[model samples]
Target chain A: MEKVVKILLADDDLEDRYIMQDAFSAINLAHVPFLVEDGEKVLEYLAQMHSDEGILPSLVVLDLNMPRLSGTQTLRELKNIEHYKDIPVIIFSSSLNVIEMHECRQLGALSYMVKPFTYEEYLLSAQHFYDFCLSKHSFPEFNSLINNFK
Target chain B: MQEITHISLDTDMDLVLVHKRTMKLGELAGLSLALQTTFATAVSEVARNVIEYGHDASLMLGIMADLKEPDKFLVATIKDHNNNLTDRINGGLVYARKLVDKFSMISTEAGVEIILHFKIPGSQKIISSRIEQWIISFNLEPPVSPYDEIKRKNKQLQELAEKLKESETQYKELTNSLPMIIFSMREDGELLYANSWLEEFTGETLLQLNVNKWANVMTPEDLAARWEQWYHHVAENKPLTQEIRLKNVLTNEYTWHQLSAFPLSDENGKTLYWTGFIVDIHARKVMEQTLKDNRELQEIKVQMEEKVRELKRSNLELEQFAYAASHDLQEPLRKIVFYSDYLYKNYSALIDERGQLYFNNMMGASQRMIQLIHDLLNFSRIYRDNLYLEKTDLNVIAAEAVNDLEIGINAKQAVIEIAHLPVMFIYPIQIRQLFQNLLSNAIKFSDEERIPHIKIYALNGGKEIQLIFEDNGVGFQEKHLDKMFSLFQRLHSREKYEGTGIGLAMCKKIADLHNGTITATSEPGTGARFIVTLPKEVVV
Candidate 1:
């Protein structure tokens, strides 16, 4: 029996979310993805999923910049909880600032990734994300994946 | 009651009795020792003259007591039987007149009588008639032996000599114990005295320190000016004070000393002697110099800080320019790219062939415009952010830049030879950008007939490291060399070369941030070489 992996995507831009969904569907990965507009909604969804009645996600992908609570703030808050500390979080931003990326990693993010400029580059990033989840590895193992791609 | 004693003036021995009786009367009247001797000498001269000239002569010593006033007097009377006095006796009368408080002679038919009176010095109060009566009775027995009188006068002389010696010792001790040098120079060009402190300071005795040549010890640089003022003040008879450097005999080093002097003059205002004190002032002079140096250094530091603040303000204005180009311009530009692409995709059938071609050109121009804005942002943001410095390997930075441009390198088929590079303290991202821009420029301007060849290497330049990038490409003319690294300066026409002309400018800006320089050299159709010199370490 094959287990269906649930993924959570939090972004502020509607067009960016649409493109990401199209990219995932184009790759033909067998997965369930939940979408949210901002980090506040992301926190709300996570809090509900912690109870017995809701479903918990296997991976959370967050945009670094948002309207209310930022992605780095949410990632730090998520890592503080005992139940969600082991769940992986990946930060995505338009900036290639190494200082911000280093801060994200220090705050217990699973990986830090840059946004693609073109649709073809976006497909490649999506394919890498799909392959990363299938491996079922921890945060340090995720760093190895980025180095191999590099 | 009054008592009187008489002594006959028959011989020299009688004259001696008259002198002794006179001194005893003065002592009983409480006169000073000097006044007592004056009274005795006057009585002896008058009595002797009377004996030599007059046939009968006698001396009477008595006390005159006042019943009402507290004052008492000692009186001497000499009488002779001969009436006429000789010229020799008149000479004695003139000498006796100046010594006594009162001198009178009464001429009678029988003889000449002389009387001398001297007021006694005592408490001005009447102690009743009984005290005056006792004084008269006491003088009546005062004609003692001549040997006893000679012994009493000799003892008084001995006491006076002892008092003069004691006063001289006290003056010497007072000057010796003073902390500073107290000196006096006499009018006849002689050094009179210097206290013991002067000997300790100069390590020379008073006789050895020749006062006439004292100016030789002063520093030559200050001597001429200070000596001129010294002589001017001395001639005017005014008090003088001066600070001068003097030579220390032990170390032979010049030390600052303060000398102050004033003239001692008589009632006629004649300059008698120069008296002064000398004090050590070297420590205070050194401290004053230290304070002046510290104030100068503090001023220089403040000026440098002001220059840094001015530089920061200009850099902030450049950042504002970058922000305007990014957001205010890119907002409209992004829409053009998005809509043009959309119109070409979904509405290509409805548009004419000429309109579709124009739309394609519009998209191309907007895309290039976006790249220009992005490069400008990167250039201006260098000073906008704080620089983080660490030990970085230049080889690693080069490898990363090569990896980033691997696809472009293969498409152009460029061959890059990298030599060993040294590690430096620098910001890693900016250094990588510098390498990437230089390498891509080499690939972009490749020669049509020949393959592209590039060499990247570093050489030590003592205090700096030189990173050289050489390329075998279509080189530029030597005349265009000065414009190579300027922003938006294009040497070639847009039809021949496709560029925004900001790559080399970005490389130059990055080098400048590290306190370094980038220079280019080229010849037509030969090659181009760029040399970037960077410091090994940066202080700030």
Candidate 2:
């Protein structure tokens, strides 16, 4: 049996959080997604997972614009932690700003994804993200799977 | 008139006696040495003619004053007793005609008479003789020795030398008194003469000055180029003019001077020497420099003004873009939210549960986008509109904002305490918007259990007015203070706080529009205090 993938999502918009959670459910992927509203809670959740017997997520999805600690700041903080460096992070934003996208990449984001306008585009990206995670864990040699999103 | 002197002309030796007597008359008449010789020569010629033609004759000499002249004339009359003396008088009158002012023959009934006139020197009129009758019978002295004639000639030459010396002294005084430095340089760059004026200017003697060593008194940087120009003019033997800086002996500092030179050429066009003068041009050069600097400053001022105009134009362009983004981009987003809501209500049963969820999410997103656009519109409108400022009561503006937020205030159970505010010059709409945004934020971010408490007050800060908004509610962390007023920056999740993240940004924009400043102080779980400072007089 394949191990269930645990994914952490940080987004300030409630609708966007619901959309991502729904995308995971509609795709029927074997994943447990934990959601947080902003970058500040994301840090709290990560620290709780370290202290408690909670399992760390295989991937982290971050929205660029949030209340307090932004996605770039969180990425910088996550990369600074030696143990969390290997966990690939994906940057998601509603804006099509290439400068922000490049800025996230420089901050060690594994992939940058723009929020889709339609339900169909959302479903396709969710399926792609799920398959990337499965390929990332099952075949460690295929870690370059993030390139498909690029 | 002088007494007449008579001399016999019978013997050839007697003509010399006539010459001596005529010369004596010249001396008594105060004639110059050259005129005295002329008078004596005329007398001898007349006496010789009388001797050659008549048997015996006598010469009478005297000085006679005329009516038209300041001085007298020397008159010599030869009386002849021989027959037809007028016809016998040959070239005597011709010789005397050239030497005397007048020569005439008077033939009387018994014999003939010849009268010759010589004008004394220093007479106002050169021809001082008119026809006059005279008769004299007097004895005159004989001629003096040759040594006496030579002595007179020597005295004349000595007097001429004195006159020449006086003229030379006057020329030297004229040249030395000039203000300019006049100098003469030989073809080989030798100083033949430098006037006293040059010596006074340089505070040095002309004999000690070196013509080729002018570079010693010139500025080092200008020496080589000016010397090359000087040498080129010399080689070409052409008249040249140049301006240079030379060290003033009096001031010991470099000063501007203009040198003008003319080459004195011989008949064959070979340059003999160069004569020139150096005139001070320091004052004129300074004025020229001042004009040049002022012109350059004017050019820079024009360039700076152009740059400022360009910056203003670019700012106006950016404001236009913001206005367009809010007004045009919001319409489509509103339609999207409306259509999504309509579809969800009318066709919910046909779509699956997951599809229904996605539709609701889309509608929520569109609604948020519309709110974002509305906030942006207000932010840009504050800058885009032409300001109409007037004295307005800020307390009344705050009350209106609170009245507009009554619904939200009641829902949050918030209490807003307002103090008396001052009347100041401000844009009414923008000031009202600022108050509304701050009031809405205070009511919206209250704690769940405790009722929100807010206070609005004003204080005079000397040159400026300070308006303070204090809220006892859930505040942001101190670390996020810098970004509190940035556009689309929020400290709480959208679910917890209903905002498009533009309230504080709008407030900041309103403050900046009035040429004021806005700052906030807050800590996590503590209350927030926002302070706005505005000048008493708005420049705009």
RMSD (Cα, Å) for all candidates, in order, is: 18.2, 22.7
For residues B1-540, write the lDDT of model 1, one tens digit per residue.
Answer: 255565667766677767767777676567788989999988887887887787778777776767575767778888888888744477768988898888889888888888888777676443446555655664445436665455445545877888878877887788777666789875443567888887777767777766534554666668678767777887778888988787777787888888888899889988889898888888888888888988998898899889889888877886767755564565456546655665676788898999888888887888888788767767766662666887999899889889989998999888989999999999777888899999988888889888899999998989999999999999888788778889898887878887888888888888988999999888879889989999998656
Give the poorly placed runs of model 1, Cα more than 4 Å off: A1-5, A18-31, A118-150, B1-304, B313-350, B380-396, B407-415, B477-482
Docking class of 1: incorrect
* TM-score (second chain) of model 1: 0.45
For model 1, how does the per-residue alpha-carbon lDDT over A3-87 read when each residue is reduced to its tens digit? 6577888998787788788778878863556789888898788888887567688788999878888998888888898888888
Q: Give the C-alpha miss distance for residue A138 in model 1, angstroms.
A: 11
Candidate 1, pairs of clashing residues: none
lDDT of 2 by residue, B43-70 (tens): 8887887888786687777666656657
User: Can you list the residue pairs that collide in candidate 2?
Assistant: none
Candidate topping DockQ: 1
Q: Each candidate's iRMS in angstroms?
A: 5.1, 11.6
- The local distance difference test score of each candidate is 0.77, 0.76
Number of residue pairs clashing in candidate 1, backbone atoms closer than 3 angstroms, sequence gap of 3 or more or interchain: 0
Model 2 global lDDT (CA atoms, 0 to 1): 0.76
